[model samples]
Target: MAQQARAVVTRAAIISGAAAVFQQRGYGSTSLADVCAEAGVTKGALYFHFDSKEALARAIIESQHELSSAIGRDLVASNMRGLNAMIVMTLEIADQLHNNPVVSAGVRLTIEAANFASPVDAPYLDWMKAAEVFLRRGQVEGDITETVEVCSAAHFLISGFTGVQVVSDVLTRREDIQQRLVEMWHMLLPGLVPTDRLADLLTLPERIRASRQAALGQH
Candidate 1:
């Protein structure tokens, strides 16, 4: 039992270390030795948990997806208005990009996956599916216009958010990501949200930020 627990800890440490390295150097530029050095683990230890850099990256992507899915599930379970939940989820992801190295690296790796020779479309698909669910619910609830196409809107939202984060990362290392997301929603909501709900929904980005901060403080 002790050995199993220790192994779990070691694997987690290796993943975290690999994430930091991947975040800094990207998958193509990073090497197993880099991961080992970053993780303070030997090559043997890394191999025990992950066979190769591609495997390591895949694990990171899976972990990231799990965390993101959990957040979406929580928001859905809270009975929050779907459009509002979508806004909050977007902001939450931006916060993760800013504050969480694992998430940041996971996103970076997923984007550059083809370059690493380990193309992963699962994360993108998962995010789009989650967005589609929220948008469909929002439409039913009258927050989103009936004219809105949920799947296409989901694709658009994910693409737009991805672009915004990439630009923000290049410009400010994601320090300004939250603000950029707010601006993005401000521009997008005009088309997707009903006119009657626009004013209230516009405040969602700030509210999400405040709520995230409060939650962080509790921990």
Candidate 2:
């Protein structure tokens, strides 16, 4: 049991290191050696955890989703539906981006790398599958428009958020970026919300906006 715990710790350390390195150097430039060095593990140890750089990158992407799911798991548990839950989840994700730089970059890197011409791996497809599930949930609850293709919307939103992170330099100005993201989310949420709930769901807390501004001041 103790050894298994250590192994789990080591794998997490490796994935964290890979996220940072891939964030700095990008998917194309990052290598197994870089991950190993950053993780303070031997090549053999790194291989023991992840078979290759691709596998490490895939793990990083999965970790990002796991972290995000944890953030909004409450809404899921509460059976919150429609735009309200989506809004809450979106805000939570934006806050997460502010809080976790490497994971933010990992998300961006995953999308950026997926644009390649060649066939991609299963993990990349899994990321898209997860997004589809989120959007489908919204649609089933009558939040998202039935005509709207959830997968495409998910891709566009992910791509746009990646650009937001790059433009604002999330690491330096997290709050500012987060506020912009929230505003963007608000603008789009109405389209997804049922007409009856639009007005009420759109009314976010003034304190939330104020708190974001205050966070910007600190940065």
Candidate 3:
């Protein structure tokens, strides 16, 4: 039992270290020796945990997908639905990107490898498909518009979230940009929300930010 626990910890440590190194250096530029050095594990240890760098990369992809799926399930279970949940979840993801070192680095690394033909696409492809499923559900529940174009809306949201992350690191006015994006979602989402509740459904980013700040200030 002790040996099994130690093995799990060692594997996690290696994977985390590999992710950090890959995030700092592109996958192609990163070598097994680098991962081993960062992981503080012997080459044999790394090979025992993962047969090859490609295999490790694949594990990273699966790890990210599982993390994303867990978050999605939690968001949906919280009585949040449709576009509202998406926007909130995406903002939370952005917040995580800003806050979590491993997650931010892993996200950046995964995105950088996104253009290449690799298994890294599997996670995001599954993510987009999940988003589409959510959209379809929203339509059925009368939260989304009947005119919904699932694929296009899903792409737009994904691209918008990706764009926000790409610029988040460089932008000095991240708060303002995030505000603008929430506003943009409000403006655009009406076209996708049911007409009867469109006005009731939309919430301004500024308002949400103000409320968030107020609540935080209370603490």
In terms of lDDT, the poorest run of 10 residues in model 3 is 172-181
Name the TM-score of candidate 2.
Answer: 0.68
Q: Who wins the TM-score comparison?
A: 1
Error of 2 at 27 (Å): 1.5
RMSD of each: 1.8, 5.0, 3.4
Q: Is candidate 1 or candidate 3 better by lDDT?
A: 1
**Model 1 global lDDT (CA atoms, 0 to 1):** 0.87
lDDT of each: 0.87, 0.67, 0.71
* Candidate 2 wrongly placed segments (more than 4 Å): 79-81, 115-175, 189-202, 205-219
Q: Which of 2 and 3 is the better model by TM-score?
A: 3
Across residues 8-99, which tens digit of lDDT does each residue of candidate 1 receive?
99899999999999998888899999998988889999999998888999999888878877887787777888888899888888878788
- Give lDDT: candidate 3, residue 208: 58
Model 2 residue 87 CA deviation (Å) reads 1.2
- Best-to-worst order by lDDT is 1, 3, 2
Compared to the true structure, candidate 1 yields what TM-score?
A: 0.92
Question: Per-residue alpha-carbon lDDT of model 2 for 24-126, expressed as tens digits?
Answer: 8888898888888998888998988887677777677677867876655665556655345544555567677667855676666656666554433543344
